[model samples]
Target chain A: MANIHDVAKAAGVSISTVSYALSGKRSIGEETRRRIADAVRELGYRPNAGARMLASTRTNIFAVTAPLHSGTYEPAHMAFVLAVTRAARAYDYDVLLLTEDEATKGLRRVAASRLVDGVIVLDVSKDDERTKLLRELDIPAVVIGIPDDTEELVCVDLDFRAAAEQSVRRLADLGHRRIGLLGHPEQIYARGSNFPHRFRAGFLDAASALGVDAAFAMPGHGPVGVRAALDELFEKQPDMTGLVLNCEEPIQASVLDILADRGVRVPEDLSVISACSSFDTTRFHPPLDVIPLVAAETCVRAVELVVEQIAGAEGPHVELVPPHYSEHGSTAPVPDLRDAR
Target chain B: MANIHDVAKAAGVSISTVSYALSGKRSIGEETRRRIADAVRELGYRPNAGARMLASTRTNIFAVTAPLHSGTYEPAHMAFVLAVTRAARAYDYDVLLLTEDEATKGLRRVAASRLVDGVIVLDVSKDDERTKLLRELDIPAVVIGIPDDTEELVCVDLDFRAAAEQSVRRLADLGHRRIGLLGHPEQIYARGSNFPHRFRAGFLDAASALGVDAAFAMPGHGPVGVRAALDELFEKQPDMTGLVLNCEEPIQASVLDILADRGVRVPEDLSVISACSSFDTTRFHPPLDVIPLVAAETCVRAVELVVEQIAGAEGPHVELVPPHYSEHGSTAPVPDLRDAR
Candidate 1:
């Protein structure tokens, strides 16, 4: 509730003196700093963010741009946002969230106004309009997702291709010869979502090497989408013994329901694993076998990289967190083919 | 990309004329207004938010105060925020999101500086600090959750008590005499979260009226919390044949796992229903029979009510969205008691 003026008045010094003491930019006598600190404690004064930034010549704020939808902030995205925020806070910085539509004007305004020192973008497409703008502005920026043009930009992302291959290898190790993949809705992949395509390529490469039949289907994000995708997959590959789900939330639930309805036992009649974030798998009904991917951790790392770039670090930088899978109740070896039939 | 000056220059008018044209305060010649519009379109000019707010009497922005946790932007909360934003956008407004901790100084700065026209507080506690501050500041505001001190406040919320009662009655109608209630975590309830307490009270009252044996427990959000709570609930009341879940996402998954692990068949061994928002229920696996509560709808309604209040509408107002349940695949009659025994 206490303002800078209150702290200054309590310290019996000018507001400028209090500001300098807090920022530690201009030298103040030890005694004066101590008096200001004591007054701040007494008044419970938290420095004004805008004024502090102005004084320090650093905003200490990172901006993130994502789509603005009714319920788009799922656990994965939320985790990413929070991770960036907490990590920034750890480094004594704050964050400003922006929408994709606002990126053109918003990024320009925030950067020109010095509201943020840097920016980190999420859900980057192959040819992101924001990326083009960022390049033109010459602002230090990082992309959470891979972009088609990463030559001059800093980025942090999962090795989805390797991750998918690893998931398939694990299933193959369990002696599953027939596999089915449940991908996100076609629209997301069609929009050039790098993850899904990378995942598909990896799965196909692994399946071919293992000499097995692999089927792929794109499911909607809802239960209905899940049911339809599964129905089509099952119809196409009725003998498939393993399932790999890449869709988050809605489809995850629907997949569980479809399996339950058909009385197909997990890891017995069918083994299941997914490339979902840890939060997604851990929170579902039957604990899913999932690769432990944390979007938030990735976001945090990206923010750090962007901050470094903003602070004058040279050259394009890329960081990848290799996918690690955690087994829960969903995966197992191929059942007896005859018995399954 | 274009500044006000560009529009003004293109229109052969002063910057003040451009500002007035945009604000529509004083009547301008029809031809001049058309020329200004043409100039704005040609230059792709957009109003600068900060400068516009400072120059004009109104900010045309609304601030939403909520929990700062990563989970705060989950589907339910995200829906509510978006709904309010969409509704506000209809009236040519923008929203400013603030966490509870930021509300005091944040609200004061925005209100005093006229950065926003009003405030809409969500996830409100019985004794909300933000609400108190807003009242003291005499800022036009609406609360999305009910508070103990309801006087002089406009509130839009579901009747959680009634919803809980209805859920219990539905169970009882299906011959579920022994029921268990899974409320949100103890920490959330302890923070004066009114919904969970209201739910508990309502369940208890309804159960008492129906002369049914009922048990209650608080589960944190996530699979671990769900498992722990379920383990505790079952240990305490093994006879409970109906279950109600209140925790969102992470816990929702756990609920399913615990049931599956315990070999408790849903709708057969236990009928489950929860006071969840529509999005939560719709996306949940084995789609839950949900008390169709929507936080965003409530928020939008509350925002409208607040706007009315700011426009000099009459005294205290309370709006309630009635409890409506969706029959997903999760709920059914309790299995015959004899078979259970």
Candidate 2:
């Protein structure tokens, strides 16, 4: 029930000073900001939307443009969205969701109306139309996925290429020479979704550098897709002993199910690693090793970068959060060839 | 580029008339409203946020409170959000997403600050806190699920109970006396999600009325969960000839895979119906007969109802969208008991 006047009186600061401290519009002293924040927490002061907008000329809201594509894994996409919302809440900003169907037009409307302080772009493709608009709109924006051209754009994402190479090295260190990668559905790559392509390229390049036989297939979905993908991988590399899964959660589970049906034991007959997954892999029957695509880490950083941009931060650039690997006994040393024979 | 003055001039009205007509604050004549609409479209006029707020005392935004619980099915949840957003867009309203972590607090803040014209509640549980807050908030709201008490609250959702009863009747008419339902994870039911409980009750009641045997199991997740649930079902009714799937998509696919492993053919060995599912059942191995929980049907209506409330419609009431069934050859006349014996 407390208002700005109460907060100002409690903080022992002028009303305009209190407003400036809360809005981050004109830089007030750090001491003044701390006192204002303390008074706000104590008094539970909530700014009236209209008064806040009029005083600061900034809406404490962010436009989150997340376009769900045909090949989108909902859990992962939802994870990113949830993370961004939570992160923005930490900065006291509400999120306005702009979905795929309204992507560009929504962005234009929000920007022109001064409805949001900045924009956060999710599910960025290699040649996205929104990225071009973001450039022209002259608004503070932080794209969560990297597009082909990063010119004049702030972007953040997991270093998927490095994650792929790391997966290969871990298997190679375990003495596996032939490796196969089960990627997303064919349309995901065909549609030029930024990360899948980056991961695939990194996998191939890492295999070539290590002189290991590598085969890759896009496991579309479900058991049938998993079966066809495995068949193709075996055809490409008959002696494959190591496998990397870089696809949706359902497909990964299907791959495990199909593998079990064929009596191929994980870490015994073939080493398997679930790479760059958003959902937990530990719940799997054999609990595959994982290089997690942590949505919180990337999204938190993206929110910070955009907030900084709104506060007049430096030129635009891309930041890639490094990938970390966790083992769950899904990988092992390749069986001795002589022993197998 | 067209401002209020330009729009007023084009429509041969005063600026205040233009504001009132656009805001729906004071009812304008139907003819004048039509003229204002025409001018708005032809001139491509968009209201500036601050000026519009000052003139109309209305924010053309809705707060969508969608709290994702542990057992929340992401695809269905995402579908509903997307549908609500698209529906709101038809009324030129934007959606501000409020997630689980910020559910009640976010709702209260938006309502208190007059940030949104109305609230759309998603994933409402039996004892939802948001519903209670909504009753006290004095703002326009439309809940997408039925809570325990609909007193003084507007509610919209698929008729889940009817959908369940229809599923039971469909399988019974196929001459299958023994029917089994594979439901969501136990935690989902334990956490008091409203729809599943309603559906389960209706399924049981319908079976009792029809003098047919009914069995239900909560398939937690994955192949192991499916196997365990099937074991439980068969133990309860050894001659189970029809199955109803009321779980997440992954669990449904796992059910088919496990059933195939045991050499059970759909609509022959047993009939299956996907009940109240949001996703397309046609993509299943043997495409299912579905009583779909259509997101758009309910969401579009919910948006309409909330807009009506914002424009001073009737008192709080519950509206249930009727269920519709579709066949995909997943059900047929039950196999003869004599032949099996």
Candidate 3:
């Protein structure tokens, strides 16, 4: 409730002196600064947000436009949001959350008003309208997913293509000639979601390059849909020795359950790898080998780049965070029929 | 990036006239208002957040303090957050998200600086420290979850106790003499989360009143844990003909899967009910009866109450949205065991 004048009077200093001590824009004596600090604590005087923004040209807030559409996997979305929040907090910044309802309008309002110094775009689609708006706004922004257009936009995301390639390579090196890919729901791919398309392409391209037999299936959700997907995958590649799951957690868990139901042994019968998964693979029945989708790695980097841009550091560029793979004995060498005989 | 001065010059009006037109603090001629609006659009002028705040004494923002602790179920948490965001938008307010790391500190900072018009608290624990800090700050705040101490706080939440009691009564009316409850992870109860404890107690009390045998178990996660919980429940009440699931989606799915695997048919053998579940229960194996935890119901009401408080209307109070039950053929009359024999 106390204003600058109250703080000044209590500290026995001018309003300008109090502002300087708090802002650190100008040097003040230690005794005077301590007195100001004591007065501020005693009176619970908080500098007005408007006054601070006018003086410093920074509100120390970032607008995080995370649109949760119909196809969003909540766990992954929540993870990324929390990661960005924590990363922003490390720089003494707070996040203004913008949901799907007012995606672009929210960004525009916050940026135009100088309420936030920069923006962090999340849940980006291939032809995202927000990306175009961000480009036009020319505000300090970092897109967490690769959009169709990259010109004059700073972007950061997991190298999904590389992750897919690595998952195939890991299985290929294990002497698995036949592999099956379980992708996201069909709508996710049809909706022009950027990452799933890239991951699928990478999987097919890597399979082709390695001369490995690969079949792809998109599971809907739950046990029934997952079972049908597995049946379709087996029908296409009956000799499939390895499987790569590139879908949400529930579907992946269902796939594992279905496999267990069918008496299929992991690693021994079918080597499995969880690609670009945000959830913990170790929790799976047989802890899986996973190219984990690390939210913090990309989100932290994105926040840092946006902060750098806010400080007027450099031009826009795309930064791809490389994926890290961990094995939990879910993958193994393909079995030889002759040896078994 | 044009300032008010630029807008006024372009509109051919005094700066004071432009301010009055934008803020609606004073009446201006229609022609002058239209001219200022055109100037604002043409020059891409945005009202300064600081100036607007100082003038109106409002930030037009809500501080949403949602702490995602270890026990948090992501889907439920995300649902509440999104619901609040949409609801706040209805009243022309944006959400400033504050996470677990700076739980109380974030609330204090936002409230003290008057950066947010009000606060929306989520994922409340029994002994939540934020409630105390909120009381001290004396800011207009509405807590979405009920904490242990409700004095001097505006709280909105689902009536978990009533939902639990209603679930038991629904089964009891159908001649289910023995009932079992599958609750959340043990840590959720051990950590003093408000709802689960209330729900559990209500279930026990209701069962006792109806003279129906009752058993309760807390499942960790996955098929194995769910199976163990079911086994524990059955061990306690072997003739359990009705079941109430108050756990996460995966655990509930696991229960259905395990029951199916063991040749236990829904409604015929076990009349299952999902209590306070956020996810669609129809997606389960055999669509179970459910008391849905409608996020929008509580969150929208909470936002409205906070906005009212911000407008200096009424005192702090608690509001509980009554639970709605939906049947999906998961409940039926208990089988006549003697007649069957």
Candidate 4:
């Protein structure tokens, strides 16, 4: 309702003086500051964000583009988004969350319009269309997930391969000769979901190197689907003594049920580990022993990188955060199956 | 990047004509359209979103604000946000997501900066600070959850009281006299969470009218906490026949464990029903009878109302969606406790 000019006139000061007083960028006399404050209160003047952006050439806003599925806002993803937001705020910036479909047109529009200083793209595909567009537009952008080509882009990624290899090695050390891997649905990988494919590759490669028998299956949501998938995996590979689950949502009760039905005990007969996010671990029934969701930290780092790049810092940079595992007593020495058989 | 002026010059047309051609807002001769397309492709011209917004005064964006917990997205809330996005897209608008902390400043920025035409606020509190600010601003706003003062606001809310009453009636029909209500934490209600408080009020009122003995408790997350909460409830009122769960996630596994531990049979010894979102129902093992997460539909309706109001439509409007229950074999006539004892 009140403009900067009105505040300036009411405070008996210049517009620049009023601006400095509000932003606290420059020092003003105590009496002048009091007068400006009184004027602002009297006029109910809220500083216009657009005018501020126009003056300082800084919107103090970061944009994020991701898919808008029901599972997209999972606890882990939310944590990552929040971490980015909190990190951005620390530097006096806000986050603008844009969905994938909207990113194609809407984000392009917002970026070109100068609504935000930089953007962090999530759920990035192997050859992300958004990455190409961002490069084409010369808009400073950071990608959360790794893309196929990283030559000229700022990107942050988790060492999924290392995490998977470590998990398999842990199982191998526990004497598990036969292991089963429960992956996300085929559609996720077939559609080029990066994390699942990377984890799967690392898992199988490590299993082969260790000379251990391994089986894989894609499980869907809910216990029924998980139960069916587990039953199929067990029926096909009845000798499997350990499981590595890469599914997003945990199948806590169903996994327990399948183990019970097969007359198996956790750690003793069948050790279980998953590539779970920290949020998932917190809510997991029998807290999983696996890598914490590094995506959040990656997001924060990506935002910082993007901001630097936007401010004309340097060339493309990449950050790879190593996975940290949470040991929760779900893994142990595999039991002797020959005696039971 | 080639600007619109370059494309316009190459196409031998005014910038307005090129704009219209690109937006498909007006009919142009086939030859003219072809020339514009060729010019755009040849020059790699992309429309600038900022300049376009300033010129056209229609950014075609809607904003959404909601709570995002680390371990829980709350299925119902997710559905609502998605529904609003999908619905907005159908009407040719993109949805922008804002978190709870960002609501005050971020929303104000988006509105005053003309980044979005209108906003749909979810998880509305009794005296929402955001609502108060929105009222002061001259932007169109819609609230998904009911506010304390709804005189001038457009709102879409579920009849929580009626839903609770209906649930009680269903339990009563099954001949349950003593019912246990497992509600969300008091902190949730105390923080002005609308649905839980309304549901509790309805449950208490209906139980009182039905002359049924009822008790309420809020369970913590995970099996251990849930079991302890259930044990406490049972200890306080051992004769409880029907259990109504208000908090969705924690109780899913705990209910099964509690029943198994107490040697109680579902439907026969106890009946369970919950006001849970559809996503929660799908993920839940041994699904409970529930009122579907109608948040998405509410979101859609709220957005529509806000857009209409922003477009200069008259009068305050409200849409109250009724609770629809699903019978998933979780409820039945209460068992004869005396005979079993």
Candidate 5:
């Protein structure tokens, strides 16, 4: 909202001098130009002068780039991006969501065109190609997921590693000797999606530390995929009395139903824990005990982080939100399973 | 991509003459001014000349204004909006999603600032206040749902009335003499959300014409509401053999679970049909017999309509797409109650 007059007054220069320096229609002293530039940055002046388009290019809009129009429709991704929109508004900024076509192109266009001052990218892949472009750009950016190399980047995510470990520890503490984990789809891990790989590693580590058995399967998207994965896991750990679900697909219902149909009463014959966003709900079954992903909080933090970086906050920062698990209904003590054992 | 030079050549005027007509920085002949304006409109020249910022401000951005950060998270609304984002891109536009705070303020800010060429408002209420301001805006706009009044508004939505009527007619054709509809939450109807009211009216009309029995409930948000509504409906119509679900809360799975729990068999003891978005899916239960709401298609059409209007096409248009039902295994002929009767 600052104007040329305000910039001039703040920089202790005449109105025409500020205009001339910005316009380059005339040359001004380097020291004076530096003073004017600092004043403009301080005031966040969106210059209306014709030639100072560069000085006025900060649109106060942050682009939210996500794989929204991709083949898979993940509701949680939508949730995270929308939450980012809300969070950005608190900083008095608007959000331009880039969801269609090669997201990398969208990223480049917005930044190159000066359509946004900063950006927040969601569902980032480990070998994410966008980070390289973002790293090279002058615009500030933050990611909702960590990538393979965090050097010279700002990243924030629900600590999936801690979430997975907590989920396992919760079940193990409940006296469950054997458990199965329905992980992300195989491709997610193959693509080196940070969350799945981190979760799997954490689950394995926790299982080892707790001296309990853990069987893992990457669940498919649909019913058959979910059933086959569940069957495969159970086959490997037939005496499994605890389960951890780390996926957010519709398989939530399928898993509960399959277990029920297989005569496994939740938390009685089996206890199920979900490592997903607390907003997730399965319709037919008792709600799973959720180790919270805290999507909205994480989104808010990411926006603040990016905006801070944009406003000259220093350093390559990484924020990992600690786990806060919510127990709704899905967990209970392992039932007397000596007969099954 | 056209420039002032293109307009100058097309209008048979000097580049400065066209600039004068656009910038009002100098006087030009009346005939030449008219020619320049025509050429500008024809070319969609986003003028960079400073003073013409007001005269020729077309940012080629479409604002997607919805209550995304509000209380309840409706995935259908999210789906419709993300579809609009995808649809806008095909027309060479980007989406600026306004989700935080009063949506009217958001709408006002975007148009007043010339930040967007047009807007798409989703989850439009029956007596929406945004339409009035939009009518006053120079920028073109469209709504995803038709409000109480259609005069001078370009509106499009799934024909909920026809959808309701179709659901009933489909069941009637299958010999369903008695049916119940689980309508939206009582507050949604109370708040005058057009869809629920329209659906109920259509259902009543269709049932009357076919001389079939119909029961309705404005249920609550979750499983308990579903159960109470079903219990109340069946308590009145004890032999109710068909159901129409016209709600989108977490009750989809609950309904099926309750039916199965109560020893009622789908399509055997009862038939069920849904009047909701085609994107609506419950992971655990058998898919419903759904008359698709066509959210993505509706959203696509809405964007095209708004962008067309922005492209100088005038309209007070209304497009109501008829229902296209999908049989996903949750409906069938009514039970043979002849023996019981």
Candidate 6:
């Protein structure tokens, strides 16, 4: 069945433009829109979700470039790549994983060889070399994470800033005056990782606006790191009643365990929420209330954007997915400490 | 420096053949070895370790085909891919990830595309459709995990069966008379997953050989699953003195937590060991004694094997990485039940 890729290819516009023209998300040139319409008619394309996913095309391959940093493969990064690969498959497209030393050169090879019809770039930092290279390629490219300046690229990511703010606000709404935000490693911030930095900024902004006492810093990962971080948090804010964790999966349990060891009751004495990507937060002990960045959804969007662009979607679009947080088993109204006192 | 990939290309053979010809791991045809030597000498190729990773190739892209199962990505599987990508980067090659509906079709697409000089296939099952497909491809391919029969493949994997046996024997050596083995989900076994099945068989076989009573089955994942599995284990063997877990990461902590909650002291009353791919077993509370499958090592080996094959390595081969286990805080000499009585 004809799908978005075909219409975009036929129209010589980006997938986003075709989508915008179809859904009126953006203003498109009349000539381009007419071409798209003509292409849709000629190709018998259907702009439906299921059809978009199963859009079989001339080339059923995607190049996904998310390299391991210094031979250490981060699980979070893996989540993004995995999601994109799986999503591409939904469209009957195979993903060619690329972990290139130089993004520009790696992408150039893939594009030159026509190894893939589209490309999905993972873990875009501010001023990413990959994004710069994406502009030089004719193949449509989508980023799993947003770079600082996406003027010439199409990108999809969770609005991490909003997610962080929502998580902090959720704690505040639970009537907690003193809250804590545990983040990624210190080096992650020092290196100016866009996502972590955005989350940190959003968290602090929300905390300031709400007039809440907040402690923000990178937590050490694993049990030892969690112990040190937890001890430091309680020492810094003895009355802290909620925590927002932005660390890796390995450290979450240790955070709660340390709190429990210190006689702090979850929800009763302290509420905790995580800004994680996994949806199975409810299965964690005490079932954390969470603001999740659904990796799969973001990945699917990226694949669609890239495929359409390759088929002729518009250039340079940024799509920030909204936050999805739930008040599950972990968050509750703050206890009346004044009454206890 | 001219590296292995160059030699393989020049020799008109798979890189693996060149590696085997050099390392004597497999027998290479005399003519092919001579060709590889002639290519190496002509290209000025150096077989040094540093050069091995940075074997600057003409294509500089490797195709990795490990599709997400039913659009769901498994973390363990991701570990393998991540390792391969990182390892490839160390050698200055790019990976082209592929997930085709039919392994046959996917391998064909990647091989035919010439997008990648070589290929790496992840998680080879007993009768992996991909390996069968791999045999037809002109590209040199390495399978990360061993299949039921490797008569037509070069493969690398953790000797899972040996790892399981080591864990079971470790517990038995600790004087644990009865033990429980928690495993992967039921569908994994039902679908005839090779690795899990091998581990189970090995565990049971070792137990019988040691005259140690053992109970084993798939434990559902996460905290809830951990708790239920724990309850069932205890119920089945009230005097169970040891536990072997092959569950996911989320549930590992829960296992330790449940035992702690039950006033069961790790290593003091009961010993535990896991067949996991993660290397940070020591960071968990009580620092689990484990037989870890170093995904990174396997990945590095896969890349190496593939490169060598392209250089004309000989024969279908299986490289079984031995198990690496240690007596960490989670295991100890089993408490003497008679003495306690």
In terms of TM-score, which candidate is stronger, 4 or 5? 4
Q: Which candidate is the best by lDDT?
A: 3
**lDDT per residue, candidate 1, B1-341, as tens digits?**
57889999999998889989987888898888999999998876767544544345455667766765543436666566556766676565556666535646566655654446788887778897777787777778888878888887778798888898898899998888888888787887777877778778999999999988888888755556677788788877887889988766656666876787778887778888867544466565567888877755676678778678668884676777787877887777778754666
Residue pairs clashing in model 4 are A113-B50
Q: Kindly report which residue stretches of model 3 are placed more than 4 angstroms away from their true locations once superposed.
A: A337-341, B23-28, B337-341
Instruction: Quote the B-chain TM-score, candidate 1.
Output: 0.85
Model 4, position B38: C-alpha lDDT score: 100
Quality class of the docking in candidate 5, CAPRI style? acceptable
Can you write out model 4's per-residue Cα lDDT over B174-226, one digit (the tens) per residue? 88998988887556777887778878899999999998888888776556667
Residues A117-179, candidate 1: write the lDDT tens digits: 788787777777887888776678888877777777777888887788888998888888889
On a 0 to 100 scale, what is the lDDT of residue B274 in model 4?
72
In angstroms, the error of model 5 at A62 is 0.7
What lDDT tens digits, residue by residue, belong to model 2 across residues A68-92? 8645778889999999999999998
Task: Provide the TM-score of chain A alone for each candidate, in the order shown.
Answer: 0.86, 0.89, 0.96, 0.87, 0.81, 0.78
Candidate 6 chain A, poorest ten consecutive residues by summed lDDT: A49-58
Please give, for residues A1-341, the per-residue lDDT of candidate 6 as tens digits: 45678888888988888888886777889899899889977875545322222233234567777655642335567667667877887786766666646455667765654545788887667778887777766568888776788887788888988898888888777688999888776767665466888788888898999889999766765567778787777789988888898876667767877777778888788888988546467767788888887887888888888778776756787898999888777887777753565
For each candidate, what's the DockQ? Answer: 0.13, 0.54, 0.76, 0.26, 0.24, 0.17
> Could you give me the TM-score of model 5 versus the true structure?
0.78
Model 4 chain B poorest ten-residue lDDT run: B67-76
- Please give, for residues B1-341, the per-residue lDDT of candidate 6 as tens digits: 45678889899998888888876889888899899889977875645322232233345567777755642335677777768877887776766676545345656654654446788887566788877777766568888776787878888888988998898888887778899998876777766567878888888999999999999756666567678878888888988889998866667777887888888988788888877546467867788887887888888888888778777875678898888887677877778853665
Q: Model 2, which residues run further than 4 Å from truth?
A: A1-46, A337-341, B1-46, B337-341
Residue-level lDDT tens digits of model 5 in A63-116: 988865444445677778778887898887888888756478888777765667
Across all candidates, what is each one's fraction of true contacts kept? 0.05, 0.63, 0.76, 0.18, 0.38, 0.27
